[model samples]
Target: MKQITILVPDGQSTLSSVACIVGAYEVLMSANAYWKDVGRDEPFNIILAGVSKKAAFDNGLLTVKTQANIADISQTHLIIIPSLIRDFQEATKGNKLLRDWIAQQYQNGAELASMCTGTFMLASAGLLDGKNCATHWSAADTFRNLFPKVKLQPEKLITDENGIYTNGGGYSFLNLMIYLVEKYYDRQTAIYCSKIFQIEIDRQSQSAFTIFTGQKLHGDEMVQQAQAYIESQLHEKISVEDLSARFAVGRRNFDRRFIKATGNTPLEYTQRVKIESAKKALETTRKNINEVMYEVGYADIKAFREVFRKITGMSPLEYRAKYNKEAIV
Candidate 1:
């Protein structure tokens, strides 16, 4: 049996924190059952291993009864880092023992997968130092700021490289789980679990679902002002030169400071703000695609569609039809 260890970090976590571990456990168990029905032996020996045998989440609403602690198990086939709901720094800070165990496990040939903000923990373990990983879109800037050595692919629903895997934020964990199922079992078994669990097995990008919220917590007053002005004038063509002049900073200095604060260039930030507005419009308003584009300050149809697709991985109409139930009808 493949020893699959799910590391349950002790802390307050998102609503899905406990659920994801249980979900992965149940799915693997179900896969084992499927193997039995098909006259095959079980594949996974799943364990809930952590620093302690018991980890309480959500203020003791749920207490996970882990069978093994980090020291109890010397090695395993896989280590899953569940999502942490709190601040990444604080969350990782409290789990140094668990983090060290994770690093040791990966070094010993055990593959690692982090779900949602669980990427924060894996990053803390220094497993993602030079590797590309996926996390929630909202946390992209923060992840970049904290772990600049790691490549952050916030748009991908799942990223699998070497022995590490990371899924995008939230319920996208299901997609990553299904992906692992496919790799561990067979494609046919993965299809069965996807049907049983009602998970989209082929989803690759979370960009369409992400509503781009610009990072403003960098604490630079001038940079924050530039951000606010650009957001305030989403419909107008605001140039970097204009923002620099208005903010009383030099052109190169403004560019440097803006990037330092926001992890995005001024022009990229402006485009995102405009696109975020367009996304909201597409989701809630009854405006046509072109109307939505023009409302977001994109007068050229080709440019608008291209930019939308580049950022969102979907066209405006596609995003609308996918998200807006009324639009579908």
Candidate 2:
């Protein structure tokens, strides 16, 4: 039988972390039971392993008893790292032993998966270097800053490269779990599990759910001014040349500084800001698509629809139907 080990990391558990650990354990166990019901022997031996025998959470209000210690588990078919709650740097530092063990296990031919912010642990273990990874969209900036070598795809619901798997923010890890089931078992079993869990399967993108609050934390006063100007003038057609001239910087230098600070060119940033505003208006108002488009300063309907779909993974009408209840009527 193949062994699946879920690491119970030592830390203060938030709701997301606790849910991921428990949810993963339950889902895999359900799959194993289903496998047995179908006249196959229990194909997986699921184990919850940790650096210690017990990991406390929520200030000792809850304690998880791990089934095996990492040191005792010489080989496993797969390892699932749960979502983390602490600061990424501190969490990585405190879990050095677990990180090293994860790297070693991967070297021993075990597949690795990280749930949400658990990508941090895998990146720290050096397993994700040069690999494509998906994590919570809110952590994209920090993850990029910390692990510049890893390709971060925050818009994706799941990423699978080589033996590593990662999923986007919150509860979306359920989709990754289903994907793994399909990979290890069969399509029928994965579909059955999805039905049981009521999770939508084959979800390819998380773009529709992302809220693109501009990345303004980088300490560039000039870029900050440019960002502010772009946001303030969303109702007007703004160009990079106009912005550069207004800020008293050359166009090439301004573009470079904006990309370095926000990870987007000035034009890309402008599009995102405009589309974000359109998304909000679609979600909250009874206005028609054209009115929303004009409100965001786009006169061309085709151009507006294209940009909206490009950023949101859905057309404006579809987005409204999904998000705005009144619009449905």
Candidate 3:
């Protein structure tokens, strides 16, 4: 049987960490038994490994008993890392030992998989330094700031490098587990587990769920002014030249600084802001497509539709139908 060890952070475990590790064991165990009863081979030896013999979760509301301390398991086929709470930094302060253990396991030929913010731990362990990884879209800025070398693909629901795997934010971890089940066992078994768990299988992107908030946390005053001006003028056509002149900065310098600070060029940022506004209006109000486009300062219907689709991966009418039934016409 393949040794599939689920690593829970003993220092500061989240409920998700406890739940994901345990849930995987339950689902995989069910799959193994189902396969065996149906005359198939058992595929996994599920092990719950922790940094300590027991770990407390949710400020000591619950304590989990680990099957083995991480040090006891010198070798395994795969190591699963569950996400901490929203802030990876909060739990990582006392997690050096856990991080080192993870790195050592990877070096010892064990594959790695992380869920949501758990990718932070993997990144911290330097396993994701030069790999493409997925995390919560909300953490895109911080993740980019901390690990510039790692290609952060927040839109992707899962990323598979040589043996290192990462997934997008939140409950999407269930889908990641299903993906692994398909890989290690069979697609039919994964489908069986998906039905049992009521998890939608083969969900590939988190982009549709992302609401672009216009990142302005980089502490660039000039860029912030430009962003504020763009947002305030949502009903007006915004040009980079106008913004540069208003900010008293040269066009090239403004473009460079804007991209550096916001991770988007001036035009791209304005388009995102406008599209986000259009999305909200579609979600919350009763407005036709053309009316909404005009309200957001896009006079050309084709341009507005293309920009909305480019950012959201769907047309305006489709977005409205998906998000708001009352507004659907």
Best by TM-score: 2
Pairs of residues clashing in candidate 2: none
Clashes of 2: 0
Kindly report which residue stretches of model 3 are placed more than 4 angstroms away from their true locations once superposed.
none
Candidate 1: misplaced stretches above 4 Å? Answer: 244-253, 327-329
- lDDT tens string, model 1, 101-218? 8888888999999999999988988889999999988888889889989988878999999999999978888888889999989999999999999999899999888878888778
The models' CA-based lDDT, in order, is: 0.87, 0.90, 0.86
- Residue 256 in candidate 2, Cα distance off native in Å: 2.4
For model 1, what is the error of residue 110's alpha carbon versus the real structure, in angstroms, after optimal superposition?
Answer: 1.0
Worst 10 residues of 1 by lDDT: 7-16
lDDT of 2 by residue, 138-228 (tens): 8988887888889888789899999999999688988988988888888888999999999898998889999998887788999999999
Ranking by lDDT: 2, 1, 3
Off by over 4 Å in 2: none
Cα error, candidate 1, residue 223 (Å): 2.4
Task: Note the residue pairs that clash in candidate 3.
Answer: none
